[model samples]
Target chain A: MPPFDLKDRAAIAGAGASAYGRRLMRSAIDLAADAIAAALDDAGLARERLDGMIVTFGSPIGADADTLAQVLNLKLRAYNQTWAHGRFTASAIQWAALMVAGGMADYVACLASVSFSGLRRPMMGGAGNSEGAREAGGSHGEDPVFGMTSPGAGAALVARRYFERFGATSAQLAAIPVAFRKHAALNSAAIMREPFSAGDHQASRFVCEPLHLLDYCLINDGAACVIVTSAERARDLRKPPVHIAGMQPLPAGREEFIWAYPGFGVAQQSVFDYDAGAPPVYKMAGVGPRDIDALFTYDAFSILAWMALERFGFCKPGEAAGFTQDGRIELGGALPMNVNGGLLSEAHIMGWNHQVEIVRQLRGECGPRQVAGAEVIQWANAYGDSLIYHR
Target chain B: MAANQDDYAKPRPAISALNRPYWDALRRRELVLQRCGECGMRWYPAAPLCPRCWSRRIEWTPASGRGRVNSWVVFHQSYFRGFDAEIPYNVAEVELEEGPRLLTNLIGVGAGEIRAGMEVEVVFDDAAADLTLAKFRPRRGAA
Candidate 1:
């Protein structure tokens, strides 16, 4: 196989996001259309210019993939349903970039929108806690016989193991939420914009043991979209395009997914294991964890975010708690992460906002939340339940 | 206490051609896996081609019902109503004696005792009408 070179391959020219706060009147399709139109306008591209589109598998009603395609009225040569959940929005952009680079399509639109506003599904109506509610998604074949089911409760088992192995404390974990919320406060689009202290995070109600309510991401109705095209074409367009410098997917493995249940705490046991496929997401972008100008991580759950910091080589394994202490992840730290408020404050539209923020940062369009001289951005797509948390 | 009685109403897993033999073997209280006839690669969720060499020559073989727990989680919350009655059950990823890692459940033991690399033996759950599911329990002295 040839080496993956993304120089002038594809570019993200524009990004748009719907109102992240609660919106009772607009349907999911409307949110998607608004975001799509805004993104196209930002890219200075016509509707007919798009030749490919990608949408999430878990899109809410009215915001489904087909619905967005119909609303956009763009004839698509390629339409891919993403499984990255929210994190996949970035994945979608990556795939679209590949498509554009390989001549499958010239322009593509990637969108993720959900309205947990009026959903009645059990998985949709997560337990009041983030992890607890997520655990309740699929049927437990035999694990249920002993009363094991809630996500939070399930995650607590892993948390217990992590704590036991590393001597990590809940107080240290609480810093993740405190730091994320602190960053979100500067974001006007963020939902939980108020400043929160570790004391406040500790004082919040416990959703699961070691996981306070503050550690969980909130669900809200929102949509975000971005346009991807060849870098040459993008450079000719009106807006600045963030080139796809490096893109790759990490293979699912025991460590990546079921870390809580690894054999000897090592990753090589699983047959599906393949660390070779892991794209050097940080290094390929010509930046290291310390060199990242700003971060737009998918903060679907606080643990997922902290784990990403560890997985992407930002902090040493089991040191994310200390890595995020004292408003470090907020701003003016070694690396400022998730300036858009993330899922906790922004809206849980499946990390699409993370994509929006990356584009905005690349375009230097982020207002007061903007990091100085921010040239590069790093984000991820995460999926799965107890197995894989984030991509 | 039966929180997931409603979740059972959902349809059971559909067996495809690649996996039908494995599921059928389960109905007969046997654990089955696919072995590449040409390359000696053992696998589960039986696929058409050998993952090792990408060869299509493979055969279905009965397993020894012996393996070790690779990793496991005890889920206490029910995602679906069908599993409400059986909350807090253990879903384990096991490395079979024949050399394939399969996702299954651990039976005949409490969830708390489950650990990585613990030796386990297969025990069939045949209560269902169409299929007999394969489960495992910790092997005595196998820890």
Candidate 2:
């Protein structure tokens, strides 16, 4: 199959998520069952029709593909799993799209379920996740030898670098979390519903210096599933098809930091002036950043929202600090983002929640938090993977 | 149970065949990085081949032991029990003269005082008899 043929050929048919909460005290498969069933039901897809699965955060924290199939009575024909990383959410959706388009699977459920409460110590760092003990170092640039542990620690480093490079202040970065919380106040399913002000953000203690506690995301238990099928099959389903207009796969290299943009220089990347120069997702979708009605990113940390904004040509390298201010990214703003409150205020289902929200918003299913007259929505990220979804 | 004063409770680098030499050099109080003999590209956290040239012709030589703090962060929360005593310790990503960045803790400066572009030099910490850590301290006579 030709590559460009994939543009708008595949799409999200349905989306659903389990309850988002701290210490839900449920097994991963139990939570996964709730998400998978809800997603299948949302599309009017029978449980027997769901034949493929791409499970992220699978293994120690979530349900594995094989285990989920066996326990859930699923007869999957194609299944794959990635390590417990939120960044894999985009990769899973992209693969599911290809699988559906290529006749490998008719229906693919891309989802993640995480139970962070069960672990005695949080897996953010020196815990069962083995993040710090990986070969060379952790994906987040964690070098435990120097006590540089946790993914947030890496993001804090990027935040500090960005502040120095752009002359931005921690006070300015507060706009991101503050804005997301406002969106959360409207989202009943969101975990952090209480609204907060910039003063509250400033009053919050620093988990890692330069990053307040609010800048970090909520580590809660939940499962979110988005079902993928060919655009032809999706149109036949219950809901309007959320077409996969464009896809930019995840990238990694010396220049690529998992949490920072290409030239922003977090890990092995060099320092330079970054020009986001028409990211391929926009081109594949035949649209520009300006055409995006609603934008959703993997907001594991508030700094990442800044990174994603600058990464996909939405703003200049250092301009996101200002571009995100004055309710710019909130609902009713010029460009609303994360109307479901995102991982920061919603829940971290390894970014599967963002996918669910994207599907809902594209379908105009998001009631109060919906972007009015929204036809195009995007799942862009700091790590350079993106999917442009249009209804 | 009494805590072993002699035991190193902190997380240590899992010395593998690939990065054993990097740790060995640190144990010797000498800072060394893989300098690709073919492409002359140097890097850290040790790789088997040159990342740039993909050449196996690599040599480990003494580094300048000097760099500037590229970025830094302070950990107010402890992830490792061994580090709980130093709850607010700072970790600085130093950009070396060879153009590779290393994540290390800076001595001779408090967490609040460290700034980006501050000149620093590598200092060895004999963390354990079998393990050594490469730390950095602010360089003298630097503006």
Candidate 3:
């Protein structure tokens, strides 16, 4: 079957996220409901108007679509649950948009919530789910034997190769978290608001060589929701609609742990390959990096944001360290990035907060953190799913 | 030279019926992977059929035991209790000459010395009484 063009058929009517921090003592279900209700309220839609729901999160936390539906009292015509780790939010948005555009549902809510502190489970080990544990130990039987057993370790391997190949420095990579923290200082809901200098970032303890503790994202308890509806319906909603202009899922055949084992060349090639294809997101939306007014790539780790900057063609490969060095990614810079502080400082809702930030920036509602006169925005995840949104 | 099972308590791979051959070969100090009888394509983490051609005609073939370091990392923190004493060990991805990558440790070299594209050869570690792991070390005389 030919791919359907999803450009501008549906729009994000509203977005909302619960207060984010460590150990909020809230169940995943309650957090999801909080965000969902807030989104409905933001859209000025009654609960009965919701026809579909999408729940995305770590499966071990135990809130599935049916349970969330029961908790939110949602009787839906359609629903889906995505388990694609960090890309869950973007994947859910795509599915929600398709459902709305295909007549499967009129109004859909995409929700994601996580309570890392509440679960008290380490990110890796036998104590966690079997799949995560297996992958942590090296899916092919190598990593566990050597004691490299966390996501941070896997990402650090890629960063190390990037440094060796591109001559990028740890001090330069430190600019990422430093800039995001600066933006977080302006955000009232951000978890880590204290500003730190490059020296401070450099002095931070190493979680894995080449990645300081500051490079890791916060483990928090929070949830975020975005409401989607047809463009016509969104026009009549309470807030300005953020159009779903274009989106592209990760190109086929790239594994989730592509960065862990593939050489820098392979990782770099995949990004360039996808861009060369004139991916559906760019082709259907009629936009490119040059047209985007703001950028919001997933920053699960500081290096991820750096990789996105290079992969998305914002700068030449191996130049992101320099591109991000001179406030270029800070608010009011050439390309404001993670203006809502991103996962690093804002919160870790599995990139759901990024979508919230996009809607807020396009609606011109971010107050102090808003990018002036922003219209077009792009959000992407490390796995390569990208969506372009416009006001 | 298998170690007692009690020596290592970390999470072990759940060997399935499909992947039993791969693990059994490791126990015998040899490395083997799935190769499609039809397409001649080889893959790791064993499968029942050729991932490339979907052919049930498959066979287990021994690897060349030589590859280059594709990428690597050193864990500074221990996520599993069994790894606590081994913090800061290196895990590397070695791309074999025959076109499959394996996650293993690079021995006979410091984590600081490992680099991308450095040649490496396979070594076996009997991590537990019933489980033998495939690891790698720098190739002699290769920088």
Best of the candidates, lDDT: 2
Docking class of 3: medium
**Candidate 1: tens digits of C-alpha lDDT, residues B42-88:** 86546788877888888888889998876565544345555556665
Clashes of 1: 37
Interface RMSD of the candidates, in order: 7.3, 1.0, 3.6
lDDT of 2 at A244: 92
Query: Candidate 3: DockQ?
Result: 0.49
User: TM-scores across all candidates?
Assistant: 0.75, 0.98, 0.92
lDDT of 1 by residue, A1-391 (tens): 3466764478877788788766555677778888888888888998887788888744434376666667667788887885424445556766787788788888888888776675555343233222222221222112232233344443444454456556777778777677777777878888778888778878887654445678678867778888888878988887877777655453444233432222323212343312222336644555455556776666655766655665555655567667777777777776787787777777777777777787777777777877778876667432221101110
Tens-digit lDDT track of model 2 for A91-113: 99899988887778999999999
Backbone clash tally (model 2): 0
Q: List runs of model 2 lying over 4 Å from the truth.
A: A1-4, B1-6
Query: What are the lDDT scores of the predictions, listed in order?
Result: 0.64, 0.89, 0.78
List clashing residue pairs in candidate 3.
A137-A144, A142-B103
* DockQ of every candidate structure: 0.11, 0.79, 0.49
Better of 2 and 3 by DockQ: 2
Candidate 2, B34-57: lDDT as tens digits: 999988998976888998889999
Superposed on the true interface residues, model 1 gives a C-alpha RMSD in angstroms of 7.3
